[model samples]
Target: MSKKRYILSVALIILTLNPIFSQNSPKTEILLVGFDHLGQMDNGTPSSDIFSPKKQKEIIKLTEKLRTFSPDQIMVEKEPSEQKQVDSLYKAYRENTLKLSEIEYGSSETYQIGFRLAKMLNLETVYGIDHYESTSQSLLSSGKNIDIFKNGLLELMNTARPMKKKVQQDSLSIYDYIKTINQPKFIDLSHNLIFNLPAYVINGKFSENGTNTVDIGKIDEKYIGAEYITLFYNRNLKIYSNILNAQLDHNSKRIFLIMGQLHIGVLKDLLEANPNYKIITTSEYLN
Candidate 1:
């Protein structure tokens, strides 16, 4: 082909690939802010009383810190099906018609952090992206000759007990404890607790010449431990899906997700792997 023809052909090819290239690039900046549950529910973990004047003030401070990110959308750990209820409560709160003490909008993080942040940013609605699967620790103890696995879990709990007690005894504010938990070391530890512990019990106990007896009972126990871990993973996967399904403006959307600290490690990994998102660390905002 002539020089002009060749140049025009190349230009056309570049033009054709431009949209695909852009599509592959990151468009959204997601700040994954993992927070402890605010309501102090009976979830077998230490719960914070966020209703105190001191904790409330700290929450305000936390909101002020998060406001610098100027997130366009705030996502919470509530299920997607609950969006209508969340939107309704948010609207009422915005209008000064709903009291925080009201049963409809309790001290839950969805209301405390997510709703408060969205209001601070002047956003109309907060998004709910949680998916729940009934999980039971008893499953790990169900099969025979599973005492090793049970003991391993007990040991893990004992490991975490001191930190929990120290946080309570040191009089660390809810904000301070949350900040500590979001740190890299703590996040890594949380990840291991969820992913590594199960694998250790399953692989170490069930492998040939392992600690546990190589019998049908041990195999079943190993499978039970694995199933328990799988439920944890599946719940996080669905939560990530709900995040993606949220209706967000592509032009200038920055999403801030407020979720339980336990969900953060897996969700962060999933978000980091997606090309459509640029994961923003909590340290960047909190610091």
Candidate 2:
């Protein structure tokens, strides 16, 4: 019990507590909610009336569940180029000085979902991370390929687009509808509608499903199939880039992003690969 024993005991105590003090912080938390654009869905069918009393109740319920997440930043599918415009609109909305109908974006998910959630969380800024890219393609021949493409579109018309043809008349609430789209099956359906469809047909036969990676084929035949798929990936890739840029090294532990359901499949893979993020889903909250 001399000086040497006392020094050894002190060293052991310091070493044992170092790990507790210096442990790495957990990775950033991200929740990607693939919310259908409510306003746009009112096109063909006669539903998705967000302003309706019933739908408003559902929206309130949905946001109540999302409120638990209390995200520091809310990212929307709108383009980042409109940051100043969005900031102004959001500020007005937060201040209760703006009526959504007064603005063109009121019907957009950027307002219905993004603005609503940001307002609920009492957040100051909503980030727009969407990207646009030019694309060109079409069906030119009649064959099994055309049949497949038509069938895919039909399936989407029936299944993928939410709140269609009297959704209000039906029983499903907006909360439940949003929950359904966040599921993996719904995300896969969206991906298949685009990539798995027979987008490029040369002759009576069609290219294999998901053959977006084009090879150097005959000079006369352009790889329309690959180009079509590439366009989807390209736009989503740019959106991913925008998300990273939007993050701005802020200390946001949880970030909520609202995008088209189609984006979930691709962005999930991209964000999962990054070591700095830990991806979460609505399944935990919505269910």
Per-residue alpha-carbon lDDT of candidate 2 for residues 1-287, written as tens digits (9 for 90 to 100): 99999999998778556632223545678999887777765543344566767777777788778878889999997788988999999999889999777778586677877888898888887988988553322332344356666676678778854454445554677788889878888888777767766455334433343333334234223544544556678788899988877774556778998887778888988989876678987898898
Question: What does candidate 2 score on TM?
Answer: 0.77
Which candidate leads in lDDT? 2
How does model 2 fare in lDDT? 0.72
Give Cα distance to truth, residue 182, candidate 2, Å.
Answer: 1.6
Task: List all candidate RMSDs to the true structure.
Answer: 7.2, 8.7
For all candidates in order, the CA lDDT equals: 0.71, 0.72
* Candidate 2 Cα outliers beyond 4 Å, as residue runs: 1-25, 43-48, 134-146, 161-163, 166-170, 196-222
- Model 1 residue 238 lDDT? 84
Q: Model 1, range 1-287, lDDT digits (tens) per residue?
A: 99999999998878657742345544689888776566753234333445656668878888888899998888887887988988999999888898677855377778888778888878988888888665544545444435655666576566555655554443666567677789887777667666656654442223333222112332445455565567678778888888887834334468888988878899989988876778888888787
Minimal lDDT window, size 10, model 1? 209-218
Q: In model 2, what lDDT does residue 55 have?
A: 72
